[model samples]
Target: MVVVNVYAPNIYTNRRRLWDKFLSLCNSIEGIWLIIGDFNEVRVPEDRWNSVFDNNNALHFNNFIGAAGLLEYPMLGRKYTFLSGDGKKLSKIDRALVCSDFMTKWPNTSLRALERNISDHSPLILSSGASNYGPTPFRFFNSWIEIPGMVEAVNRGLNKQGNENFKDLLLG
Candidate 1:
């Protein structure tokens, strides 16, 4: 599993750069990917209320998501994630987006909004609601071999005693 936390800049140019960076990086990910963040942009006009709408920004944001093959589970408990200081404006700027690999691995994933306190932004919770099935078999990815000292780590694990420690070493 791979997790990415982002804080996209408010400016479109900077945000576009971030998107470009992520787009370039996305193809290399072979496992489940979850991206959660304050993106500072909306996917559509409906995502914002009482705020200036930017069609260009929204178009680019949607394009990025589509091009990257990212999926967003519908937000629950709230329609918006950000509120203006005066409480007049609302926008769904924060979200959790996953790759298809993630959805395939955890089909029950969900995104939920939590109550906002002092901050103008409300917190988001991403849940898979998966039940434990005891010990799962360990599966190694080819990418792990590229990491420094991974072979040494595996060798050390191979020498370790007991099934519990060995199982936990790889996937716990």
Candidate 2:
């Protein structure tokens, strides 16, 4: 089983480009796929927690998703995930979507809204494939180095260790 994540930027007003890229990506992938991120688009006026704003922009995005054959993952928390800084325009900007293939491959894919960490947009967690193992901490260390060399180092370490445990922890 393979997991693919797609994070598209907010296309609040550009539906053509968004739809075109979505179509190209859907046709290109072969296995189970999941597209999860802040689309900045809405499927319907009801999708927004507050419906008093200009929603012409959102309807266009909804059409794009429908035409692309992608289904929205019904939100579990408060419908609104993003709010304009001024506290006037509220919208469901962050969301996750999946194709039928993903359902067949990993039916348990669940997305939840995490606390907003870096950006105003909430973090979307898309757990596609099942894992008996639970959540693992993600580490980020900035080291100025060559990208290809990092790959080579990882490959060499894997080959030498052959799935041995604690190598990463020990090295760190």
- Top candidate on lDDT is 1
Candidate 1 lDDT by residue in tens digits, 1-172: 8789989998899999999888888877676778898999998889999998899988888898989999998999889999998899999999999989788888887889999987888889888888898666677899999999989888876766766654446422
Number of clashes found in candidate 1: 0
Candidate 2 per-residue lDDT, tens place, 38-112, comes to 666666676565455446776666666676577766666555777777666667767876778767766777777
Error of 2 at 52 (Å): 4.8
Worst 10 residues of 2 by lDDT: 163-172
For each candidate in turn, give its C-alpha RMSD to the true structure in angstroms: 13.9, 12.3
Listed in order, each prediction's TM-score against the native is 0.74, 0.60
Highest-scoring model, TM-score:
1
